[model samples]
Structure formats: structure tokens, C-alpha cells
Target chain A: MRIGIYGFGSIGRLVAREAVKRGWEIVGAIDIDEKIIGKDIGEILGFEEKYGVVVSRDVEELIDADVVVHATSSYLDKVYDQILSLVRLGIDTVSTCETLSYPYYRYPVLARKLNEEALRYGVTVLGTGINPGFLLDTLPIVLTAPFNIVEKIVAKRSLDASKRRKSFVEKIGIGMDPEEYMKALREGKLTGHVGYAESVYLIADAAGIHLDKVEERQEPIIADKDMIIGEFKVRKGEVIGIKGYGTGYKNRKEIIRLEFHAYLGAKEYEEIMVIGTDYEVRWRSTGTPGDQGTVAVVLNIANIINDLSPGLLLMTDIIPFKPFFKH
Target chain B: MRIGIYGFGSIGRLVAREAVKRGWEIVGAIDIDEKIIGKDIGEILGFEEKYGVVVSRDVEELIDADVVVHATSSYLDKVYDQILSLVRLGIDTVSTCETLSYPYYRYPVLARKLNEEALRYGVTVLGTGINPGFLLDTLPIVLTAPFNIVEKIVAKRSLDASKRRKSFVEKIGIGMDPEEYMKALREGKLTGHVGYAESVYLIADAAGIHLDKVEERQEPIIADKDMIIGEFKVRKGEVIGIKGYGTGYKNRKEIIRLEFHAYLGAKEYEEIMVIGTDYEVRWRSTGTPGDQGTVAVVLNIANIINDLSPGLLLMTDIIPFKPFFKH
Candidate 1:
């Protein structure tokens, strides 16, 4: 199958390389980054050979591709036009947009428009990734297939921030003081993880459960003593990393919760606890790499996007088992 | 939704009770037991209140139910006529029949005919339960959504035989002589577990992986010393329980494996290991009750069976995700 990569960011590059590794043809690539716009896709992906597919800034270059893997942004509103253009081109596209995983929770208006636009053009547009699409949300829903009645759900992902990419560490404010980190977070300077409530809503909606309120928050993790992590050093009583949480409530009682932790020296693991009537299933895994996990989810999704109905869809629409549906 | 229970045995009764508790109407029930054929389902379920729905051997009484939950047998061939009758009546149905979960592997001709019949009548027919339907097969496939390329999968379910019902203990040939257990198993007096290859085929089919060969085996687990377990006494070297395995291979390399253990004093848990290109994920959970698990799976499927397209659908076709597909 011919494929296209639209973001050319770290995730996009990884997807292009993996798609090629899977023996699929890379038809074209689109990126706004001038540094690599005219370069061969092979060189950009650090391959020994050139793929002969050059990175272009024009979305039209991907017109002939069967599917385009969009890894540009996290919010549906921000990438609304980018996805809209791809839909009009009649290309099946799966994205890494966090909010798009459950757009109605945050962008009901835009979601309606996209759904209509995609149906008109007869193309499928999907948003999925590791956390919002799988681990913290979709996995929980799938794990609950054996449950009689789900009462509460808690899904968690904890990663070592020091081991992540430099950009990720900087985004979470690894070297900032506690007060400074809080100030920056409040001022939108140091944004922590996104898509907590997206995960919560996705799981809740898949289970046919309702929540009156959904909330998300992030805070800095303070260090006790000086330590060196990666290329950075931490002082006593300073910020080490970030911890974030999302919770869903109904009638003033919590029904779903999601936890994301990325800190130096953090134990890496993913846990999903599903508490149902007369049974509780707790599934814990040795954590997966976020960057590679996205590539896997996207590529795996690309293989089946053509089979899906044309519309703005989420991971729930494509998974092959019967999810809870109230008839 | 109005429901019908076919084969008001243990699983069927449990489903009836759970459905009533969920506020769904138990319109009718069918069972072959002459003693309870004319009895009220509520009383048979030990509920003080009468539901006014009587258990009858005639399938015609359940023609009005929106859906029927069939728990008669494990083999699809044995229940083919029963399921086909429900389809002909224009009612959706979900069954706990083990091989029916992936009938193409065992009864290809019946599967095709059933699919056509269900489609002709505009009703969905499904086969699902805890073992073949969820843990060993569907759960493993769901857990691999985050992986890029799944190279191998291993799923295991271990339960305590002593905690299960007397019939289950007898089915596994617990407290029998080792040689007698083997003879009984060979003579078909004791059938340890059904649906190993069915689970293998279901998971393999979902993951879009091809296995050239599939094999299954069961053996008795012997006791080392004198012991007492659940109203039974065991001598040294006697049978305590059973262990079974199913394996799928591609080019003689194992790609999928399933393990089932129901032994006295066994640690109860479920584990699924997904080994992919560059990552491996292991999800272990506290054990779920088998009888109740079947009830949960059937009820959950009952809630969504109407949403599914009319066909002899397995768990794979109705699940709500883009299971791997090769374009």
C-alpha cells in the first residue's frame, strides 16, 4: 500500500521508517519544516539508502497515497484545517491528535463538521496514539470485555522522564524550581502531558457509561537530594519531573481515572484496574516506549483504515470486538 | 431489552438471574429438564419473587424475545440447529458454545450456512464465552493493539479446580488415578477443555497472522502427597487436576500459544504476553470466576448484539476496533 507522512516530526519520521520496514511504499511526505522540506525521505529517516520520496510542504503531494499518517498536533481544533484538507483529498488518514481520540468531549462543533466532510468525500479520518488511543483508554475498555458491570476504572502509565527525548524532558520542565514550574505551567510555558480526560472519556464512552464531570491536572514532582539524570542535574528540593491525572465523576462519585507519570527514577509500568460487580481485573505491563508505541499503533491502524466506514472515527470504531452498546 | 434463556442449566440460570438484576425482561426460557420445564424461572433461580416466566422445552415460547442467550453445549455442531432456529425466528443470539466462537476452524460448512441463514433473516448470531471468547483469545488480540508487529503471543489462564463446581471438577477428572485419567480422556469419558484451537484461530485471525499448523494437548496433573481437596481425598501420585495447551506455528516456529490450568491448590491468575518486533508486553490479572465470566460475556454481548450486522459473527467481527488487516 502506498502511504504518506504529514507531520515529519519525530513520530512522523519513525512512522516513515517503520512503514518502509514493513515493505510498504512511501508515496510521499509533507512537512512545513524548511530544514528537511527538499530532502529525500530516506536521508531524513537516517537510512543508508534514499527512498526517492522527497519531503514536500504541499499536501497535494500526498493525493495519490492510500493513507496518510498525521502526527502533527494533540488538539483537534489546532489541526482542524490540516485534517480537513486530507479528508477533501479523499485519503484515509489516521492521526496522533490527542483530543481527536474523543473529539465530542472537547470539540463537538468541529467533530460534527469533520464527520460530515469525511463522509461526503468517502474517506476515513481517525485519531489515535499510544496513551489516548491505547494504554490509558482503549486497553481498559477492551480489558473489561469479561466484566458483568463495570463500577469504576483506573488506568495508569509511568515512565522515566530522564530517559525520554530532550524535547519531552524540556516540555515537562525537568530543571525548573517547584514554584517556577508551577508558575510556568500556569502561564502555559511548561505544558505537561495532554489527553488525560481524552483517555477517560474514550473508555467511558466505549463502556456506555456517563460522567457528569471530567477533570485533568498536572504538577511538578520535587526532588529531595541532588542527583544527575541523563545530562541534567537536580538540586535538593527542586523539580524532578511531572505527575498528571484525569478523573471522571457521576453523581459526585468517581467512575474513571487516568494517571500519567514521567519523572527521573520512576519505575516504568502500565496498569489498568477495572472494578466491576463481583469481580475486579488489574492488568499491569512492563511499560512500552511511547515514541515506538505510536508508530506501531499508527501503522497497524493504516493497514485497516480502508475497511472502516467513511467518517471521523476513533479507535473504538475500528476495534474488532463487541464493545458495550445499550440497545 | 427482552431476553430468552436456552438450556436453563447452570450458565443459563446464572445469565437469567443477572439479566433480571440488570432490569432486563426475561421473556421466556427453554430447558430440557422435565422437572423444571413447567417451573417458574425465578423460583428455579432461588429468587423469592416470581418472574411469571416459566421454563419450557418448546423453543416457540421464546419467539418474542429480542435476543436469546444459548448455553446448551460447547460444540457448534451440537448447537447448530438451536442457533439456526433462533436466527430463523428473526432474533439476535449470543451463545457460550466454545467451538462456535471460531467455527471455521472446526465446522466450516456449518459456519457458512449459518452465516447465510442469519443474514437472510436479518439477525445476528454470535458465539462467545470466557475461555474461547475472551481471555485466551480476544484479550490477547486486544492487548497487542499498541504493538507495531506482533511476532509471537502467549496467553495463560490458571484456575483452582477445588473452588469450581462439582461438575467442573469431574470434567477435569480430579482425584482419579493417573492411568485411569488418561484412559478416560482417551475414551472421551473426560474431556478436559474444549476450544484451544478455537482460541488459537480466533486470536490468529484477529491479529491477521497466519499459522501453518495448530495443535492441542491435555494431561493430568498428579499429586505428590496425600491431600484433601473440596470433599475429596487424594492419595500420593493421584490426579489433582488437568493442564492443557494449544499452539499455532508458522514455518514450524510458534506464533501463538494458549495455556489452561485448573488444578487443586493452583494459583489463580490470567496472563497474556505479546512479543513484538522491539517490545514485549505482559498483562497479568487476578483470576475471574469462570461461571460468572461466561454470564458477564454473554450479557455484555447481549447488550450489543443488535448493533452488529446480521451474520454468524464471532467476537472478532463485532469488537469495536480496527483489528489488523492486510491490504
Candidate 2:
């Protein structure tokens, strides 16, 4: 399959490398930066040029490819117009964009617009990645396989986010004034991603439960003392980490627990648990260095686009309980 | 202590009888029903007159007591002003009124106003009962005792409503059209108890977690066959039960799950579970006929009023996990 990758930054470049290794053809790469455009994709990631495909600034120039892989940053509010453009061109698309995964939960009107556009174009659109997509959607479904009678489902993904990008660190209010961090949180400006509620909604849909309410909550950085990160000294009242949690309840009973935590320079772990009438199942996995799990999820799904059903799908709709690739 | 029982209904009469048995002085009883005014409290509950306390429709006259126990029905919106009036009169009060437990969660502005009035009057105001107040508040704290490291807390209270009052049966949508029930649920009009969110919030506060988000959800009643009760025949599409759930998440992690379920003519059961680092503790209690558990909680707390700290308190704030009265 000839694929075009939009946003040829870190994750996008990694996806390109993985796709090449899997024998998929890279038609071209699209990036917003003019300097990066027309450059060999391998050269951007410090690899010797092998595939002759050059990065293009023009999105329309890459529309002829069989699939468009969107590995853009978390600034998804701006990407909707581009995705809609692709939909208008009748191009099949898959995104690792955080907000688009479950747009309806956060950006309801935009999500609806995207869904309608995708349907109108008759092309499938999918949003999948580590946190919102996999933990919320895929993990819950995997945990429920053994239980014919599921009483509740709780999934938690905790990350030592110090190794993450600077954007992530700032978004979670790490190494910032606690009061300011809290103010941003209350205003919803600091919500790093928007799919926590969407994930709960997707799981409830899969579980055959019609929920009357859905709620999301966050835990701000409550640091005992301040420390320095990247040359800036944070004070005692400053935040060094933050946690976000979303839950779905059945009949005023908690049926699903979706939690996400990111800490500056800490150990990372992910767990998914389901409570049922007969038994309970839990899956815990450690994240690789530098948020490699995020890269792995994107690549894993990229390799199986053919096997997946057409249309917009969440992570739970695609991820398998067992690891996708055997060592 | 001189105490007046307001709203001489089932719960109020039960409180009066229990108080009489404990040798506590019953100042009087009050109800909205004019027909019941001036009647002996004993005659209201089919018992012989012994306390010489008469039931009256005059709420103002009843507020003269040192304490007034408000055990009114669910129409708290109508009585909130009256309750506030009594609180302003400097009466130390305990209420089983459904909406009083967490006025902040349900009616925030009113709860705050009442709180201010109670503080200004130097009087204590408390709301307590079996389900929303005790099961959600006291039970969670009790379950957390064994675990030094609590990762999450989940509480579930399920009751078979066959033995419930006629008002409860109608409110829960038992023997009602399912479509209409669902419509009411969507409109938020069918929310039977608004205190579920308050219960979760109170528990979260006790746990010392600053919750970023709290969400509530409900489930529709689904039955494969029609249910017949008395002269009312509920179709399969009609709701026979309802479930309400509230969850509090800290740092995007699931920390507390509070749930309540009511069914018409149903068996009663309550369970509290605390998931901690070292161990998980679960307590399940079954009720005898006529919601004896509800009476137990009220009577237990009343017996220890002298031992309690001098202030307003919820069921959890006053009642110890141990037996109220040793056998």
C-alpha cells in the first residue's frame, strides 16, 4: 500500500520507518514546515536516504496515495479542517491525533461534523494511540472477554511523563505554579487531550449499557517541594505532575474507571481491569523509554489497516488483548 | 433532650417510637396533614398513647423544641424554605429528608445558604439515612480502615423494591412505560435522588483527595416479560427498576465509585469495597423486612448523640463502625 504521512515530526517519521520495514510503500510525506518540505524523509530523522519520497508542503499533492497517516501533534483543534479536506478528497485516513480519537466527547460539534464528512466521502477515518484510544477503548474490551457478566470496568494508564515532549510536560502543568495550574484546569484550557470521556462512552457502547451520565475529573500537581527542570527552578507551591481520570457508571454504579496520570521524569505503568460476576481480569504493561508505547501503538495499528473494518473506529475497535507482534 | 419529630410519616413515626423506647423525651410530632393534627403520636402508628405527645400541623410551634428531626418526603424543594426557617431559629437539627444530606451536591446555593444560617445561629444541622447518606459516606470510610494504601473506593447498594413504599415504586418507574421512563431520564427529571453526587464528593473529601472531576450516570430498566403488581400491569417496555451511579476521579484516575439501585418489591442489600495497596475490604449487609437497616442507622446515630462531638455531622461523621448498642 502506498501511504502518505502528514506531519513528519517525531511520531510521523517513526511511523514512516516502521511502514518501510513492514514493506509498505511510502509515496510522500507532508509537513507544514517549508524547510522540511522537499527534503528526503530519511534525512529528517538522521537516516541515509534510501526511499526517494520527498516531504511536500501541499496536502493536495499527496491525496492520490491509498492511505494518509496523520501523526500530528496534540494541537488537534486546528487539524479538523485538514482532515475535512482529506475527507472531501475521498482519501482514507488514520490519525494519532489526540483530540480526534473521540472528538464527540470533547468537541461534540466538530466530532459530528467530521463523522458526517467522513461518511459523505465514503472513506474510513480512525483515531488510535496509547492513552485515550488503547487504554480506554481496547483495554476495556480485552478485559471483558472472559466475563459473560461484567459488573464494572476500570482502566488506568499511568506514565512517568518526564521523558515525554515539552508540550506534554507543560500541558499537565509540571514544574509550574500550583495556583496557576489549577486555574487553567478549572477553565478547561489545560485539558491535554479530550478523549477520556469519549473512551468511556465507547466502552459503555460496546458493553451494551446505556449510561445516563458520564463525568471526568483531574488531579493537579500537589508537590511537597519544588525542584528544577530544564534550567528553571520550581518552588514548593509549584506543580510537578498531574493526573486525569474519567469514569462511566451503570445505574448509579461504577462500571468503568478510566484514569491517566503523567509525572515529570517518573516510572510509567498501564493497567486495565474489569470486575464481573464470575471473575476479574487485569492487564498491566510497562511503557518503554521516552514514551515508546505511544509510537508502538501507532505503528502496530498502521500495519493492520487492511484487517480492520472500514469507517471511523476507536482504539477499542482495533486493538487485540495479546501483543500485536511476538518477540 | 427535648426533640420534635416533623413530617409524621413512616420514618418520622419510626424515629418517634425508637426515641420513646430509648427513654428520650419526645416534645411533639408535626405533619402537613391537618387531619392528623392534634392526634396522639401513638395512635398514628397504631400504638397505645404513652408519651402524651400530640401530632400537629404547626411547624412553627414544633420548632420550639431543642432539636427537630425532619423526616419529610422527597419534595424537599417545597420544604427547603421551611427547613431553612427552622435552622435560622437556632434549633439543633437532624433530618432524614432526602435532599438535606448533600444540599451542596443537589442544591448548591440553597445548601450554602442553609449552612450559613446554621453557622450564624450557632446550631447544628445534619442529614442522614441508609442509602445516599450512610451507604455512600459511612460505609466507604469504614471499609478504608484496614487498608493504609487505598487505590480506589467503590460502593454499591442494591435493593429489591417489592417491599418499598408506593411512592418509591412510582418514582423508580416500576410498572411504568419504558419509553416514558427513558425520556424522563434523558431530561434529568427522573433522577430520583440528587444526593448521589454529594455522597461521592463527601467521601472524596474524607479520603483527602482533591478530585478534578466527578460524573454521574444512570441505566434504563429492561425486562423481557411484563410484570404485574396489584391492579397495575407494567409492559415489557415499561421500566421496573433504575440504577444511578456517581464516580469521583483524582488525577485522571478512578478513586471512588458510588452507586444506588432501587426496584419495586425487591430484596435489600448493601456492599462497600475499598481497593488499597495491601488489601481489599468488602462489607455486605442485608436488611430485614421494612428497610430495617435504614432504621438501624438512624437509631444507632441517635443513641450516640451524647458521645458525638458537638457539631453538625453526617452518618459517617458520628456513627462508629462498631455496634451502636452491644447485645
Against the reference, the lDDT scores of all candidates come to 0.86, 0.64
Per-residue alpha-carbon lDDT of model 1 for A1-327, expressed as tens digits?
899989998889889878876788989899899999999988877789988999999999999899999988887888999999999899999999888989998899999999999999999998888978889887887777777767788888999987788878888988788998899999978778878988888877776667789999999999989999777799988888999999998778888889999999899999988887777878888888888887888888888888889999988766543334222
Query: What is candidate 2's lDDT per residue for B39-108, written digit by digit as tens?
Result: 8877777775545778777666766576777877654576687677666666767777666766665677
Weakest 10 consecutive residues of candidate 1 chain B by summed lDDT: B318-327
Q: Which lDDT tens digits does candidate 1 get at residues B42-105?
A: 8998898888999998888999898999999887888999888888889999999998999999
Can you list each candidate's DockQ? Answer: 0.56, 0.01
- Candidate 1 regions exceeding 4 Å error are A320-327, B320-327
Residue-wise C-alpha lDDT for candidate 2, range A1-327, written one tens digit per residue = 677888888778877775665467888788888888788877877776556878888888777678888877554577887777777877778787777776666677877777777777787777766655655576456434333345777777667655667666777877767778778878867865456787887787655467768888777766666666544466777677777777876677777778877775555655666564534545444432323445445544554454445566665444222111001
Off by over 4 Å in 2: A73-77, A186-189, A226-234, A288-291, A306-309, A316-327, B1-327
User: What's the chain B TM-score of candidate 2?
Assistant: 0.84
True contacts kept of 1: 0.64
